[model samples]
Target: MWKFYLFLLPIFGVNISGLYAKNDQKIILATYTYDTKDRIENLLPFADLLKSRFEGKFEIETKSFPSVDELILAMLKKEVDLVFISTAGFLSYIDQADEFEIAGTLMVDQESESTYRSIIAASKLSGINSWEDVKSKSKGLKISLVNENSTSGYLLPYLHFQQRGLTPFKDNFGLVEFTGNHKKSLDSILTGEFDLAAFGENDLQNLSGNEDLIHILWVSPAIPLGPVMVRKDMDKSISEVVEQNLLNLHQSYPAILESIKAGWIEAQNASHFEKLTKDFYIDFLK
Candidate 1:
C-alpha cells in the first residue's frame, strides 16, 4: 500500500506542473488607444485562431491605457510583454533602443507599406498660410499641440521649427498649449481659442467635417507609421510566435482585417529611429 501511494503522488504532481506551465506562457498586450474597446471586440476572431494554431504553447491577453506614457511605464516595469506605440513614443527611448525589438508593423492601408504626413493647421480667419506666415503672425497668437508627447502633434512640428531657425517661445510662436488630444486641438482651432494647431494627416482626415473652419498650412515629409514591439529580454521563441501570429492575422481572420483596414507585415529591426536622435523629438523619462 505504501508503494502504491508514492506512485500516485508523482502522477498528480505532473498534472499540476503542466497547468502552471500553461499559465506562465501566456502573453500580455497593452495599448494606449480609446479604440481598444472596439479593437478587442474585433480581435476575438484572431485570438481564437491563434489559440487553435498554437495549442498549449501560448495564450494572449490585452490591456489599454489612456496615454502612451502610462503604457511605457507598464512596459518598463515588466507588466506588459508587448506594446503598439507611435513613432514619437518609440523615439523617447532612442538611447535604450536595445531594450526592445520590433516584431511587426500595422499596415493601415492595403498597400504593402503606408506612411503619414504631419500637418500644421490653423483657423482660416487667422490668415496663417505657410510656415513663414506663422513666423510673421507671431504677435500674441495662441497655439495648440495635441500633446507634448505626440509624434506628429508636437515633435514633428517642433523639430521643423527648429530646423528653420525659429524658436518657439523665444520667437513668440504664441502661448504654447497642449490640447490633450487631436480632436480637441482641432476644436480649439475652430473655436478661435487657438490660432494654430499641429496634428497627423490621418487625424485631420478623420475630422474632415470641420474643413470649412480650419486649413492645413504645411505638411511634413512622410514618416514611418506605428510599430509593435516586444521586450528585448523576452524569450526569442515566444516573440517569434507572436510575430508569426500577427503576420498571418489577415489571412486567418478576414473580419479583423476589414475592421482595422490593415494587414500585418514582416517587421525589421527598429534601429531606424536612430537617425532621428539628433532631432530631439522624443524624451524618455528614464
Candidate 2:
C-alpha cells in the first residue's frame, strides 16, 4: 500500500508539471519602429545577453510597430510585457499611467541622463535666423517633422509656436508634413523640398556631408530621452531581475555596450516622466 501511494504521488507530480508547461508565460518586448525586422536583429545582442545572464529563466519575444499609439494600445491590452519607447510615446500613454512602470533607460553618450533638443534646421539658401525670423519667413513654406507623435519633431516644435503667440495649424507655420524619420526630415530640409525641419540633437550631430547645406535656426532645451518600461501586471521579481541585469549589461558584455551606444541606468517610476510632461505642457501653453 505504501508503494502504491508513492507511485500515485509521482503521477500527480508529472501532471502538475505538464499543466505548468502548458500555461508557460512568454515575455513580449515591443518597440516603435517601422523597420522592425532590422530593429529586432539589432536588439538581439541585448536580448541574448539577458538570456545568458538569467540562464533562460524567462522567455523573451520582440515585436515592432510603426507608432507609439499602437504600442500603447498593446500595453493596455496586456499583449506586451515590455517596451522601448520615446519621451513622446511615454506621454501619449500617460492616462494609462498605472498600466506600466519604467524598468530602465539608455544612457547614450556616457551621459547618465539623455535629453533631446528640437532643432529648427534650414537650408543655407533659406536664410532663416531666429525664431521670429522663422515665423516671418516660413509663411507658406514647407516644413517636415519626424512624425506626428515625435517629441522633438512635432510636440516640442508645435509648442514652440504657441509660446510665440501663434497657433500651429491655424498660424502661418507653412505646410506641415511628416518625414517618417529624422534622417528623412533632414534630407527634406537640405534638398530644398522643405524650408526647415525639427530633429533630435543626435540626428543633427550625426549628419555627414549635408552639414554644409543645413544650419540650425534654433534649438529647444534638453528633454528626456528614451525609456524601457514593463507592464504593471508583470511579476515584480522578474522585472527586478531584468532591470538589474540590463543596468549592469555594459559591465558584463563589452560588445553590447558598444552596439547600444549607452549603458543602462537604474529604472525610475512615473515621477521621472513628470518633468517631460510639464515641459510639453509649458510648450503647449506657450
lDDT against the true structure, each candidate = 0.61, 0.64
Tens digits of per-residue lDDT, candidate 2, 79-198, equal 787787766777777656567777765544433334456787887767775676776776767788888778888888777766776565536766888887777888887888888788
Compared to the true structure, candidate 1 yields what TM-score?
0.73
- The local lDDT score (0 to 100) that residue 124 gets in candidate 2 is 73
**Clash numbers, per candidate:** 0, 2
Compared to the true structure, candidate 2 yields what TM-score?
0.74
Task: Score every model by TM-score.
Answer: 0.73, 0.74
lDDT of 1 at 164: 69
